[model samples]
Target: MFIRIDGKQVEVKKWDTVLSAARRAGIQIPSLCYHPALETAGACRVCIVEVFEKGWSERKQVTACEYKVQPDLEVYTRSESVLKTRRTTIDLLMARAPQNAALQALSKNVEYPQTIYPPVADAGDCVLCLLCTRACEQMGCNAISVSGRGDTRKIEPPYGANPDACIGCGACARICPTGCIALTETPATITIWGKVFERLHCVTCGAPMMSIAYRDYAVANRELPEDYYTQCQECKRKEVTARFAGLSMKVHHG
Candidate 1:
């Protein structure tokens, strides 16, 4: 299918969103909550684009990540209105997470106005982007979530207590954009979200890897041998190497 973007024709495939079509045509639209691995949230309004229809000469604004491309559709990536909306969105996000270097860089790139509001207090520089929460859910933990509404909203376990279901896998910390989730790892333990977890070490290299809770979770969810205990990743790799070496020796003898 073909769509007109910024007065230029762009080719799009089936099920392509406006952002994807624009990206295929070398357009860059800033977006925060539109990860390819997660479902489209459309929470961040920074990717708003203008669309024009045949019958309606007037253009309307819509988010590129959630809006699908249509045949003969007219899209504007950087219209004056779009830039204004993006600037306002950046400024608002900056107020929520002034310490976020990524948001600061984006604000500079977009030339956002000085934030009228102060940075949110007691948030640990979190912007409430939901990236960490969504990542945890994707990993099948669903350990963390957003609590409260509006200004009081923050990421936490249920009822502001330690989660029994959390495996200390660090997926939430890894996906967090603002680096809000703090994770500490040691050979014997891992600490995250105000809780500690026991870690499993490799048999051969003695390097700490997955947590015991995570190993148990994997065993319950995935198919594995009954006798399999929590072996660290390094030991598993060494076992594979030893088996390969034995096979090579047998072949040479034969």
Candidate 2:
């Protein structure tokens, strides 16, 4: 497909979003809550762009992550209206998460000035992008979710108590842009939200693999083989190698 971005013509493939096209054209657009591995959420309005059709004189502002590129479309990644909207959005995000390093980096990218709005009181560092929850769901854990609405919103386990499904995989924490989720790992345990999960060790080599909860969770989801959890990676490799060696010997003798 062919499109015009900042008055420059660019070529892209089908199903490519404006963000992907901008990336291909070497244009930098700040975005959060958008991961290549996960779905396009458009939770953060930081990637707003102005778009005009080939025959249309009016341009409309839209989220770049969710807007697909079309032939003869004109896209402006840094239009004045887009910058003003981004500044407002960034300022609000900064007010909501003053200590968030990701927000700080975004502020620099958009040239956001010092926030005029007062910081929210008692607001945790979570930007509420739902990236963490989406990531957990994609990993087949579905252990965490957003609770409440508006000002009282928070990321927590369902039922507002200890999570019954958390496997301590730390995928949520790793995908979190604000780093609100805390995951502490030791040789024997992995802890999150005051829940301790015992890390399972290999039966053959006694090497640590992952938390028992994760193994159980995977087993419940049928993501692992019946005997897959019995050994660590190294031991599994050795067992496969030994079996192949024995098979080769039997074939030679026969």
User: What's every prediction's RMSD, in angstroms?
Assistant: 4.5, 4.9
The alpha-carbon lDDT assigned to residue 42 of candidate 1 equals 84
lDDT (Cα, tens digit) per residue for candidate 1, span 211-237: 888878877888766437545555666
What's the lDDT for candidate 1?
A: 0.81
Let me know the TM-score candidate 2 reaches against the reference structure: 0.85
Q: Looking at candidate 2, what is the lDDT of residue 20?
A: 93
Question: For this target, which candidate reaches the highest lDDT against the unseen true structure?
Answer: 2
TM-scores, each model vs. reference? 0.84, 0.85
| Global lDDT scores for all candidate models | 0.81, 0.84
- In angstroms, the error of model 2 at 70 is 0.8
